[model samples]
Target: MRLFPHPFAALVVLVTLGAAAQTPSSPVGSVSPTTGLVLRDDVVRALIHESSGDRIHDGVQRLALLARDNAGGYTEAAVWTKAAAEAAGLKDVRLEPMKQGPQWRATRGELWVAGPQRYRVTSHADLPMSLAIKSGSFEGADLELVDVGTGTQDAEYAGKDLKGKVVLTRGHPSATLRRAVTKLGAVGVVSSYSTPPWNLPHRLDGDFPDQVGWAIVPPGLVPEGQPAPFLFMVSDRQGRELRAQLLTGPVKVDVHVATEEYPGHYGILSGVIPGTRAGEEVVLTAHLDHYKPGADDNASGSATLLELVRTYTTLIRQGVLPPPVRTLRVLWLPEFEGTREWFALHGADPVRRVAHFNFDMLGASLSRAHSRFLVSYTPDWNGSFVNAVSESTVAFMNRFNGVAYPPRKDFRIGSVTGSRDPLDAHLDRYSRGSDHQLFNDHGIPGVAFSTWPDDTYHTSGDRPELVDPTQLHRAAFAGLSSITVAAWAEGPGALDLARLVAVHGARRVAEDEFRARRDLASAPATGVAGMHRLARAVVRAAYQRERDALLSCVQLGAPAKAVRTMTQSLERAEAQALERLDADSKARGVSLKEPAPSEAERRARAFVPRRVKGQELASFDELVTRAAPEDQPRVATVQAALREATTALRERGEGELRFYQLPDALASYADGKRSVADIRDAAYAEYGHVFPVEALMDLFGLLERGGIMTTAR
Candidate 1:
């Protein structure tokens, strides 16, 4: 039940197939804790089979063209998405617009190595990704090209005079800007960046020498009184060539970049399939924006979502599937910003929203990209039955889709247009990078289904042809299976779901209980009171989260009588978890009571923070820019701590936190009731890492100062 999320996609099929092979005479049904309804296995599989990789593959091709054309950007994709949704037979398809800062796009851009043997380096007309997004226009002729290796640290440019020069660095454009341009004097920027393992540290990048990364050059990145600079994103080979030239002699560079920023609105293309229950909804989301040929990054996500809309609506229309108990609303929107705006501005009621399933980068050539499909679920703080529901669904695939001839043996569903590669999927630890975070932040539990460590991630090589249809088919099938289950958590099916939740809830409770015991045993030298406090969080969180997951079934319209019965099961789970603590205390020969709050905890309890709308910070560096100069250093320290807490020390052979998840855990835990200390505790309980309370307060204070947060209503 506790499967690992690891780099090796090759897991023996025998483990999960054990149960799935024992097919029920009648296809097994999922019951809900509340409604006691049932959705038959045969019906669910039939609905999922409607997902066509062929259609998804074609969708990606069309979308890639729209993405490649800078003239259209996200709005263009939204327009296409609106039409696609309507054609797919989704009711009430529309493009919802949200106000946003001006959009930036490149018109014309070119870089050249000026000399006797003059040669053009790169151009926007040739490769649009060559120009970093939001880079301002600049024109310079025969300027010095300074080679500052990486340009991240001061030592990179310690004695070099970068004034009126193009600083060619193989670092992130933002880092180069922050250190080289913002602090040091540099006129122009060019980056030859490679993908590094940020979250899934165990994964490795392929030898993508020609891949040019998509980097950002936001406004205010440069110092005051400096010329607004332009950024060129060149391939690793191109950058190495330029760096070598600079080392040989004083290399002169000629550049001309033309770009424009216009007032743009974040567009979200959406449509809903009406359900038996009016207001209650199950939201399926996938981002639509990324650089050209971004097939794997998100065109694949958007395409697969389009297939879902098409498949589901068509099935229901044909009476092959009944109307869902809850409305199924599909969204194809820009990444983080669009999702946030929709949740904040649109009607968002946590009680009414049943679950959210976000698909990002679902398509990947398993062998080529060195990719594995990942199912990253909600943190325990957002405790909902969705985790158990999705987990079981994915676990089901771990068995159902296997290579075999014997009864209950390996089964694979392949498409002619798709690759024959096995569906390499795993249930990864929650690492947020897509639209699912907004749903969790809004208090509705969610999960993200995607692939990672992609060689073409955020690069020019993420082409449509490279996106495997078989992977897309598998992702679509797996995702649809979960979505359909959530959609129909009504009547007898709802009660069956409740049972499923109980099964998974018990697994989690047991895992947490074991962890609590382990924690206590690891610190045996401490006094009874100290020991009680140390294990208290783990034990308490386990019981608390599982209880909530069971109770969440009530949101799906479960009957009171059924819930009462389910509550008894929860009591059992709670009792089992408490037994571990009780046994530990008995062994220690001291009575254990909840430890009193420390000074930090007491301060955190009183200080409740609420997010302020309309003030969004993009990154840690951007957040630092908003803080007062003195507070900026504190923000920097917080950033450093956050980085350390999220990334695992792979050298120790430890597989713990995945870096990207920190922002979601920090952002989502700040509801009205939870104080700074409460959020901190939840984060620690969710992830084993201890994020300092002081560090959290520092970041929270900056959020408030930047108008992204306020202490209270």
Candidate 2:
């Protein structure tokens, strides 16, 4: 989808006009606490404008604006929070600063790439200043700027001694260049532009891995500053002219840089629209600040929260939602740190009843152009709640003006056993590039609204200019409706019932499938009777675990017996599988069973799994061999898809997918299948990771686009 910025002129005006004149409304069911009323529009506009206006727009701008004392200990973030609170008319806003670790400088200039194939450098500052040399030391090197025109790696730098020297040439680098660089023991490598103007300056910026000589030039030997190393470019006419001058002497250049650090804060800007119920609270959250302007990244989310607060406050004034069953709290946090602090201070128990509606980047439809929808990462246990909430929100959005509301393609449900799914963008290292990770981690029933990741990300260009006010309104309305309906629906009673039923059903399915498959596979005349029995045992064990997870998700009312039975079933299956495998190994006279548990399984059980990547998993053949060696070919196809699934996995790094499915992919693949490909494909197709091969390829391309993978071939 071609992502473009949505103009916010209308919403901006509405918000500005409302905040400046009207008095803010009191909490729901409360008397006239204050003798005034603030138009919801104005408050919304003011909050957005206050957070993202001018150079101080949406960033943790240093306290220079609010207070001039640079060394006064008040950080830009502190001042900004204070200002935001005052603008929202929040009471008792505090500017507390948390001491982050001291900053560490890049001790040496570096050329950092995804891996070691020194392809195109995409970062702005790091590339240009870095010299292209592989890891290891450069004792001494020298080479000339004679462009060998367009030719092979050997022909290009051949006849010329590049040993202990730098070589510069143009045209796409080949495996030969890789070998040449290795063979000649070249001290430096530089990619030069024969063209006149550099269109993308950011493309040329990167670090010189180990403080190597960093220079970019046309193919020419410029004048010398010393007995300089190699400097060259393409054999274009311009390069030839420069080399003629360079034979006289090689030019030398030196670059240096210093870095600075900012102390961070573990704080969030939060206010409560308290519910009439004493214990219940509903959370409407969006991250307040970011490292960049983060328009679609999260400014859109902050805006959504402000709009919802305004809408909810208005509802209270109109007595439409009097004395809500759960209090509504809006929080603008500093990602995980703020959330951790908040949870630590307030406790997560109250948040249990608290259904969360998180507004994240809802402006840019990254891949789903003019398309948006609610995503439910709930387990099968609370499938009902997931369904109701997702469906109701979409319905609400549709009612909010068909034009403003984009049609949702479908409800997306995912599971990674217990980690994030790779297909989800919000499950990244940053966890949806917002603060939703906290609530999801703590088992709170919540959903996040975010636009797809665009090109902006953490760059300076992620500004309000890209925001779509209408998109913002529609998403916020959907979020508000979901929360309101959930708040009014008593509690998790219905969901609990559904969970119980699903768990029971899943267990039945698992047992029936296990017995049927095992009996059939173990029939007397099977060709590979031993293998069949083992496969049956393995399949039964896998289903038992899957059913156990389903039970965990199932909301049972005092189904302790059912839960216990599920657990025992899984344990029994695991023990039997291990025993059978061990016996089979002993029968074959091979000590396949290490006596001790395999480290991978042990770690999978105890340690949380990290996200899977190309380097993280075994090779395709190895993976397939592990899954089902007897079905190697089919498995190889699947493994190829999985290895190429790097891009898909990365995309799913947003939101809750990173927390569950993405991490779980490793475990799913670790299932005792002899074929990694079969295991991956089966898990993906049967579970939720399935995608078209082309889609997988596209995703892989995105992840490895300009980056290189340095795996042992």
Worst 10 residues of 2 by lDDT: 30-39
Best by lDDT: 1
Residue-wise C-alpha lDDT for candidate 2, range 1-713, written one tens digit per residue:
73754568668878988765464332211111121111123332232222211222232222212211121222444455456544644434454444454322122333222223323222223332232211222233123333333325456665776554444444422322444454554444444332211112112212111112222222212233322232222223333444464566653322222222334334456776666567767677766544333455555665555545555555555444444556766676655566666666565354445466677666653333333344444332122233333443453334323432223322111111111111212211122224554454444555667654243433333446544444454455456545654454332432333343344345444543454344434434433443443344445534543554434333322255654565566567656655554454445543332244354334323322222332322222223324444444544443456545545654544222332333223332332222322333334422334333333322222222212112111
How does residue 63 of candidate 2 score in lDDT?
A: 20
TM-score of each: 0.86, 0.45
Against the reference, the lDDT scores of all candidates come to: 0.73, 0.40
